[model samples]
Structures are given as C-alpha cells and as structure tokens.
Target chain A: MRDSRGMRAFFQVGGIVFALALTTVVLVASKAPPFAAYLNIALGAFGSWEVFSNVLVSWVPLLLATSGLLLTFTVGLWNIGIEGQITFGAIFATWAMRSLQGGGTDPAFVIMLSILAGALGGILWAMLAGALKTFGGVNEIFGGLGLNFVATAVNLWLIFGPWKRPGIASMSGTVPFDKALWLPTLTAQSRLSPSSIAIAVAGIVLVYVLISGTHFGLRLKAVGRNPRAAYLLGIPTWQYMMTSFAICGAFAGLAGAIQVTAVYHRLIPSISSGYGYLGMMVAMLVNYRAALAAPVALFFAALNVGSIQLPIVLKLDSSLAGVLQGTLVLFVLLAQGAREFFARKGGKR
Target chain B: MRKINRFILVLFLAAVSTVAFGQSSNFTFGLLMVGPYNDHGWSQANYDATQYVVAKTPGTQMIYLDKVNPADRPGTTASQLAESLVAKGAKLVIFSSDDMSDEAVKFAQAHPDIFVIMSSGDQVWKDGKNAKNIPNMVNIMGRMEYGKMIAGVAAAITTQTGQIAYLGPLANDETRRLASSVYLGAKYAWTKYLNRDISKLKFKVTWIGYWFNIPGVTSDPTQVADDFFNSGYDVVVSGIDTTEAVTEAVKYAAQGKRVWAIPYDYVDAIKEGNAVSLGVPYFNWGPAYVSAIKSAMTGKWTSHFEWNGPDWKNINNPDTSAVGFNRGSVLSKPAAAGVDKFIAELSKGLNLWKGPIVLQDGTTYLKDGVAATDQQIWYLPQLLQGIEGQSVSK
Candidate 1:
C-alpha cells in the first residue's frame, strides 16, 4: 500500500501549504491591507474564465517538459539538456513554418509536418547526448551542459545569420508567421491554443500509462535501479537507457514546438523560456512521481500568473512569486529530509 | 460646546464629499515596463518620465507593471497586464519598448477608450509593411540617431587605433538606423575634420542578438567588449540598453588597456564608466510624457508619431526639450569644442537624410539631395555602406 510513502506525501503537502500560507501572511502583513493583494492575486489567476485560460497557456509547456523529465528520472538520468532539446525543436518547427509559409500548401498539413519535424529535431539532440554518455562514458550532466551551450550558439547563429528578419532583429524575436500559418486558437480573442493543450493533456496520460502499465517501463526502472544486474538479466541496459532518453527528448521537443506554434508564433531568444529548468524543479518537487507533476506545474504557473498583481496593486516586485515558490520548495525539502532522518533513527532504535 | 461639535461635523462631511468627487474624477495613468523600473537605462527613462508627469498633473494616479518579460515566462502577458491596469481605472496606458509592439497593437484595438502610446516603436507608421494603426494609438521615439552620430564622432575623435567597434544589441530597424548613423558620423568626422581617409578608418560592429545579455540566448556583452579591446579596436560604442560598453571599458582601463566608450539612454550612465566615458546622447522623456499626459487629460489627444531631438539651449533641461547629448568629462577641451560645433550644426537643422545614401547591399536608399521621410527612416532595411557589420538583407 506504500503507507509510508503516502504519509510522506501528506506531510510534504502540509509543509508546502503551511509555508505558502505563512509567507503570504507575512508579506501581506508587511504591506497595508494584507488580504487585498492576496485577493487580487487569486482573482487575477482564477477570477474569470479568460484568466484561467491564460493559466492553461502556461500549463502546456511545463506539463510537457515535466512529464518528459519524469521518464528520464525513472531511468535514473537527469536530462539537464532538455533546454537545448527544446530549442532545437523550436528551430526545426520555425524552419518548417518559414519554408511552407508562402506556398499554397494547406496550413493544417504544414503544421502536422512541422510538429513531426520538431519531434525529430528533439529526438536527434537527445540521442546525441545519450550516445555521448553510453558510448564515450561521459557524464550526462556535463554532456548536457555542453550541448546546451552549443544549442544556444546555433539558435543565435540562425537568428543573426540565416533567419534574421530583413533589416533588423530584436529580442521581439522573428516576425510572426502569417495568420493562416499560425496554430489556430480555440476562441477568437483568447490566447489559448487548443491543439497544443490537447497534445499536452494526451501526453501526460500516455506517459502515465507507459511508465506504469508496460514491460518497457518495468525494464527501464530495473535498469535504472541496477544497470549491471539489469544487463546480466539480458534486458539490454544500453538500449533501454537510449530509448528512455529518446522518449524524454520527444516530449521536451514537443513542448518547444508547442511554445513556438501556440504562444509566441516566432522563435524568440527566450523560446525555451526556462520551462525545461523549471520542469526539473517540478519533477523534483513531486518526488519524481508523474501523477503529481501536473498539479505542481499548475500551482507554479498560477504563482506566475497571479504575481502580476504584486506590481499593479501593491507596487511590489513581481519576483515575489518566485520567492513564494522557492520558499515552498525549500520547506517541503526540509520536511522530507527530516522525515527521512527520523525514519532511519526509528529503525535503528 | 454644541456649536463647535456641529461645525466639526459640517467640515467632516465637506471633506468626505470632496474625497468622493476626487475619486470619481481621478485619472489613473498606467505604464507597462518590460524591465525593472530603476534599471538606469531604457525602462528607467520611462519610469522617471511617468513620475514627472504624475507630479505635474492634478487628480492623476500612477501605477506600473514592470518586468513584464514575455508570453512564455511566468507572470503576465502584456495585454492582460494592461487589462489589469485598466481594471484599476487607468485612463491612458503607455507600453514601452520595441518588444511591446504587438501588445500595444492588441491593446489599442481591444480598448479604444484607453489612449495608447508605444515608445520606441514604429508599428503605427503607415508606410511600414502590414500597416495597422488604430485611431487611439500613437507611437513616440526620440531622434536618437543624432545622438548616435554624436557618439560616433566622439569615438572617432578618441580612437588611437584607427579601429572603432560598435557593441550592438539585437537586429532591428531601430538598431540598424542607430548603428548606421553612428557609422556615418564617424566616417564624416574622420574624412572632413580628422584629415583621415574615410576608407582608412576601420569601423566594425558586433551584434549580441538581444538588447541585453540574456545569458544563454545572447553573447555576454562584457565578453564581446573585452574581445574588441583584445583585438585592437580602441573605441567601443554601446548600442544596447545595458552599460556593458562603459563598464567593460572601465574594467579594461583598470587592467591598463587603453579604451574609450559611449553609453546610451540615461544621462548619469557616465558615472558607471567615469574615466572611459565619452559624451552620451540621452533621451529626455519628460517633455514628451508630460505633454502627452496633459493632452489625454484635456480631451485633446490625437494619434500622431513624435520623434524629438534635444533643445540646444539646455540639453539637460528637465522641462521643455533638451532631449539629446550631454558631453561627458572625458572629452578633451578641443574635442569638446568640436562636439559643440557638431551640435550647433545639428540644432540648425543638419540633414543626414538628404543623402547619396547607399545601403550595405549596394542599393541606393536615397537619391542625392533627396531628404528621406519619417516613414523611410522608421523602416531602414539594412546597414548603410561604409558600416562593417552583418547586413540584414532580404
């Protein structure tokens, strides 16, 4: 029944809630009319349907990246290069959109092909890191780090060199694609793109099934737990590791593609938008459990969406949201570590 | 005692009524900033200007949302943030920066009652490709090209290496025009006054592909500046928002490498670079902001693009005009005199636009003696000839 794990989860949730509540109270009490700013934040994020849709806009990428990171975490890998994979995915998607923009090609067909290209791009980057680790015996963390730099360089090169807007390029990023080529939105005025959200939702479910319901998932866990033993059992540890990376990359890349197609509609320098890194945090916060990643990501996204009220209502820095997030995560980790220490002590006694 | 108590109640009720009237008539002014308010650069200029206007105008309240980074990041979208300000009863909204163009357009269309002003943007200009300007939207920019030219002249006058470098941020029409103007000024002073062949002057520009060093996405401007000094380029002119040129110049100078720089935007940025800082052509956003605010308040607002230059009488004057260059402490007496003469000619209406201007791609942009229009200047498509940089050619 994993009763101990359940108890740990319970305490973790309790700790986060307490930390957040205390922080809000302190911050608000420090300011005049404590609940007003908090109220604004709540109303800002969930006050209306449109506001909630904005939260969903932030959700798709975080969920996609975190879900992918869970797969790698299951296989005992920290896929830190997810940012680069995301960038490459966007680059490929942008390339596809740029090429097929003017011709009489149906936008739907082009979008389909572009999404595939994005997945391929991500898969390629992920496999490169995997090959470096499996074949060359390099640590994945450092390898991923190096690849991240290379990917940024490549993104910059394209931005300034081949893909530069005619006459000028600014941080505003590439000129948006034609209205026809843009990913169609669900409603006319809202920023929420339905296709991307649908893909992300389906992605989380598929990942859950893949990890919990399949033999491949079991073998992946086995390899991660003890690669040497897994190899002795004829599970082909190298293949499993490579496949896990490939799957993770596919998801991260999909996140990048959605970010490009749905949100910005152009490859800005911030196309990765730190979601890959944030996803790492989200995964860790959920204790690498895939089921909890969505809720955690939603909470962070809401924190981000809601924090806008800080500057408008209270003249406070919007980064207070980031402070709340950091505090919550820190307290949660402390609670877990303390629980672990007592559990170990109790067993010895 | 009864009479005194009745008088106090009457006074209290009068005060309460006035407060109610004031609340109903309060003009809430909103400013949307893409960076920190006190950045001492681009965003600071707008913030200070907004404060200046609020102080001058009666019954006006001020609120701002800073670090509204982008759609992908957490926090808020520009449109939604603007909406929040409007919810707070903002009557007029100013979306600052080139990056906020799309947001400005969306907001202008969505909220017609709120007067919209987009600073350093050209999306409202008619001649631009895909011209879309709403009746309520107005675009304003400083004639900073003149300042860039002055900065270029300062660099040309200071360079001992005969090689000048421009540390540019992002590639855009605004950046291209600024960089090109600097190149033109440097080339002119070199050939006309310095008695050096314009061909002999080596001017090369390196772009960091963003307005600031965004770590992973953009090359560090400090490293880029260090490379310029390391490679024998003696004068570095900053074309980005950050003070990396002057700060890096100061760092290089501390290391005993002789270098000079000109920082853009804020007038006080010279303090950051000190010994290495030449003159800065600064923006005085106060005059424009105050005027625009008053216009909105008076119901006399109309949509029109305004690009201003410094008032020669007092370049640092806070109130009316003075939107241009303030010579820094580094200029030698003779160099300062030369810069003054340049400014004098500029004030009397110097026309760089009437040009035998050839673009970097070797296409003629302006026929000889034909002055370029405001729309033409707003939409420059490439770095001009004689400027060594990446040509953003179609």
Candidate 2:
C-alpha cells in the first residue's frame, strides 16, 4: 500500500514539474507576449463551451488510442505501429463504406461494417508485426516500424492509384463519402459527435476492466513484468503478447474509423493525426495505467485544442506547442527521478 | 447520465460561438498554415502576406496556426478555425494550401457569412454551384508552374551538358504539370533555339514522396542532386515546395561544378553565388489576398476563382502572381542574352501549353490546340517521353 501511495505521489510531483517545464519552454520561445498568449491558449481550450468542444474534438481519438495502447502496455508489448494500424483501419473502413454505398444497406449496418472492417484492418496490420516478432525472431518495435512504412506506402498508393477521385488533381485522397454517412456534428461549429465520444469512453472502460480486473489482464501483467517467469508457469506468453498487440491495434483502428466517419468524412492522404504517437506519449506519461490514460489523454487534447489559438492570438510559432509538449513529457520523466531524490532527502532528514 | 449531459452542454456551448460568427462583422482570421511560417516556402509566403494585410489594414486582427499536419487538419476544421477567428474579431480567414481544399469547401459550405480564401485550389470553381458560392468564399491560385516553364527555358539554354534533372515532391498532376511545363520550355529552348533534338537531352524526374524529412529517413535533396550531377546532369529544377533543391544547387556550385539551378516560389533563394541560380517561379499572393479581405470588409464578397500568373506588368504588382529572377553572378554574356531572349519570347505570346503534348510512355495528352483534360493534368503519373530519367515506381 505504501509503495503504491509513494508511486502515486511520485507521479503527482512529476506532473507538476512537467507542466512547469512546458511553461518555461513556451515562455522562452513565445512570439507574442507570453502571458497573454498563454491566456489565449487557456481561454481557447477551456474558457468557454466553444473551447472545450474543440478539446473534445481532439479528445475522442486520443482517449480511444491511448486506452487501447494501455492494454498492450500491460502485456509489455510496444506496438508502435498503432500509427499504421490507424491508417489501415481508416483505409479499410473507407473501402467498406464505399462498397456499401448505394447498396440500400441500412445505415446502421453500414456503420457497423465500417467499424468491423476497421478492427479487422488493425488486426491484420498488428498480426504482421506479431508474426515478425514471434516467428521471425524480430523485436516488436522494429517489426511495427517496418509495418508503418508499408502502411504509409499502401495508403499513398490507394489514394494515388485505384481510389483516385474522378476529375480531381490532388494529393493522394479518396472520393468524399456520402452525407448520410457523415457523423453528425455535435454542434454547428465543432466536429465532435456523441457516438464517437460514447464509443471512445466505452472502449476505455472496457479496456480498463480487461486490463485490471480479468485473468487475461493478470497473465498479461505477469508476462510484462517477467516473461521468463510467466512462460515457466505454463502461460502462453507469445499468444498473450500477440493478443495484447491485436487489442491495441483494434483500439487504434477504432480511433481511425471514427476519424474517417465522424471527423474527416473522407480519406485524405494522412488520416492518422499522429494520435497513435500521442497516445504512446500519454501511455508513457501515465506509465501505462488504464485509469490514468483518460485524464492524461484529455489534458493533451486540451493542449492541442487550445494551441490553435497560440499562433493567432500570440503570434508565437505553433511549434511552441510541440516544444511544450515535449518538455512536459520530459519533465514528467525527470520528476519520476526527482521523486526518488526528494524521498532520499526526506529519509535522511 | 449527468456527466454525459454536462459533456453535451459543453459541446453545445463550444458550438454556439461558431454559429454566432456569421451574424457579426467583428471577426478574427484563423490562418491554418501547413508548415512553419519560417519554412521559406509556401507557408512562409502566406505568412508574409498575412503580416502584410495586418500591417496595412485596420479594424482587422488575424489569428494563425502553423505546422498543422494533415491529421490535425480535420480536428481544426477550416470552418471552426475560421469561426474561432471570427469570434476573435477577424473578418476574413485564409487557409494557405491546395491541401486545404476539402476543409475549405466544407467550411465554406457551413459558414455562409465568413469570407474564406483558399490558396491553390481548383474546386471553388468546379464545385461552386453545389456549394452555392455565397458571396463570401473565394479561391485564388497562381500559375507559378508557367513561371517554372520560363525557368526551365533558362536552364535548358545555359546547360553545357544539355542534360537536365527535375527534383519533384510528389507524382500528382500539379507536380507533373509543373514538370511538364518545364519540359515543354526546355524542349522549346533545346529544339527551337539550341538546335538540339529532344531525344538527346536527358531530363530525369525523381520524387522523394514527401515535402520534408520523415524521422529516421534521410531527406537531403542536395545529396539527391549529387547523385544526378555525378551522373553528368547539368541543370536541376525543383517542383517541391521547399528550397531543398536550391540548397542542393548551391552546394553543387560550391563544389566547383558549373551546374545551374532554377528554383520555385519566393525570391532571395539564389544568394549563394550560384548565379547560375536562374530564377524562382514565385506566387505573389499579397494583392489578391488584400483585395479579397477588402472585398469581405466591404460586404462585396464574390465567388470567382482567380488563377493569376506572371503577366510582367502584374508580376511585381501587389496581387498579380509573378516569378522573380536574379540574372546570374556567373552568367556569361551569351547565356544572359539567351535568358533575356527566352523571357521576352515567353512574355510576348509563347504558349507553353500549346498542344502536341505526349507522355513519357508515348501517349498523347493533347492534340494541337486542345486543352488537356482535368483528368490528364490531375493524374499525370509519368514524365513526358522526351525527358530523361525514370519516374520512381516504389
């Protein structure tokens, strides 16, 4: 109990330091007056219902992708190909939606097929990494990274070649989806949809229960902590690792599906907004806790939503947001180390 | 249930300001830039234009977001970003990229009152009737590719080896057209003036698949130039948005080779003593942008699409698009004369798009006096038959 409490306290201090470091970087690199600019960011992100809605627009995908990442994290598998998985999901979902167009299929059924296709797309993408990791004796990271390049190539090809929109000279992109398929906007101004938000929230809850309260969760954690020991204890360690990766990929796919159906309503050259990477950041920042993923994801989402105002209101470079984000994550890591120093100092006292 | 209700309430509030924007004049312009304003490319040009409007115009303030990747493009819908600018008191919003077309169209569709000016988009005219061109949304693009053809003419005339190379960003029609224009210009110079057959000149196009660097992968276009130069190519042209090609030319020039370069977009890129650094096919977006904003401010928003180009009289003018040039530090009298003669020929009545066009694969794209189809130009995947080098197939 004391250990867990100490860890929690460590995280708390880490969060504060990370925030301060992020602010310091922004303060130094500000293009507009710093405080006023930050105020605009804050106001733009959460000062009104409008700003928060913007945050929600960014939040839904981050929540889904990060929560999905948490499952794989528990199993000690790093599925960096979440980016590719997200792309595949969007691609497959697009294919499914396009195929079902004008078929007179129920809209509800069409949506389900789209979501299911996204899951399948993610699974297929993740399984390649899994196969390379399990059978080919490659590390998951390298496998996932390779798969990412392949997915990018595939996506570009699709947009440029077969799925090229008629009469449009464009960067790689597919034809726009029907309006009936577009996820209705939550408000006149925002892209947030209730179904997307619900799906992400539900996914987080289900993943939370799966990773924290189930036998699979326990075995995955055991494998993550000590794969050799778990293997010796008759656990199918490889299967669990693959399973975690698949689950992570599926969650990423779900995020991608929502990006297409709810957010973009069309498959552009890049649909995965680096949400996969951002999710990885959130997972790392929370140390891969399922419960911690949502709040952390929301915080980053708020930052993203609010940062749009930074350039306009402050005239600061938008890259400042990236510097701040990198600082926050770095300081959080530093805070983890600082906690130990502070504890050692306190003990001596 | 209560939490969901609160979430819904917050979302509703977030949307209220977007709708409130159409009914008001006190608006903020949300400038969503795809790259850093300091990138010295398309984004920088837009940034300079935005700054120009801000400095010259009163009662108007602009909000800008830069380095927006394609993924972030949707979340910050052009409409919402524009509306946010509107809420912040900007009367006009400018999205600076052809990539922003879909977002711009969607935003323009949703917000009828907010004036939106999207750069390099062809859809504002094609889809105008469907989106119902509310006097508020307009599309403006410059025919910089024509300027590229002019630069191509200069490069071809000055080349000692007669073998030229083009380093393009993507294989899309825009890149293809730009490259095609250059090839046409080169062909014109080589055939009409230089007394060289097109079959002897080697014009190769290599696409690096992305605008800038991707982590862990080297995106040094200068190294790409080295590969071409080492292989005996003399003049190199760039079709990408970045100055990487010009930088490559500078490096190659410093290496004591007489290799020349012609760059695209923005002036002042030719400064590294590579006077063989021909000129830039730049888009001067300021005049049109200022005019559009003034139109919006005066409630005279129109739905016309303008494709401005280097008309000489209008080239350096505020709104008319112009290609800039620095003659050459090393240009010999003859080479300079050649450039002057070609620029005059182009300025007088030379149509680069004049038909009798064929693809690298020997397919006719245009017959004499026929305009190329939007499909042919938009989906140009290969180089013309006469150009050197192979279109990358990976």
Most accurate candidate by lDDT: 1
- Candidate 2 Cα errors over 4 Å, as ranges: A1-11, A29-34, A167-169, A337-349, B1-30, B54-60, B71-80, B126-134, B210-220, B272-276, B317-326, B359-385, B388-394
In terms of docking quality, model 2 is acceptable
Taking chain B only, the TM-score of every model is 0.90, 0.82
Q: Give lDDT per model, in order.
A: 0.80, 0.73
TM-score per candidate: 0.88, 0.87
- Clash total of candidate 2: 16
Candidate 2 lDDT over A192-283, as tens digits, reads: 78888888899999998998899989999999999999999999999998888888888888888888888778776678888988898998
Q: What are the per-residue Cα lDDT tens digits for candidate 2 across B207-316?
A: 76555544433246767767878888888887666776667767777788878777666655565335557766676777777778877777777777776667665455
DockQ of all predictions against the true structure, Cα-based: 0.28, 0.28
Q: Write the per-residue lDDT of candidate 1 for residues B9-71, one digit (tens) a residue.
A: 776665334222323657888898777787777788788888888788887878888876653
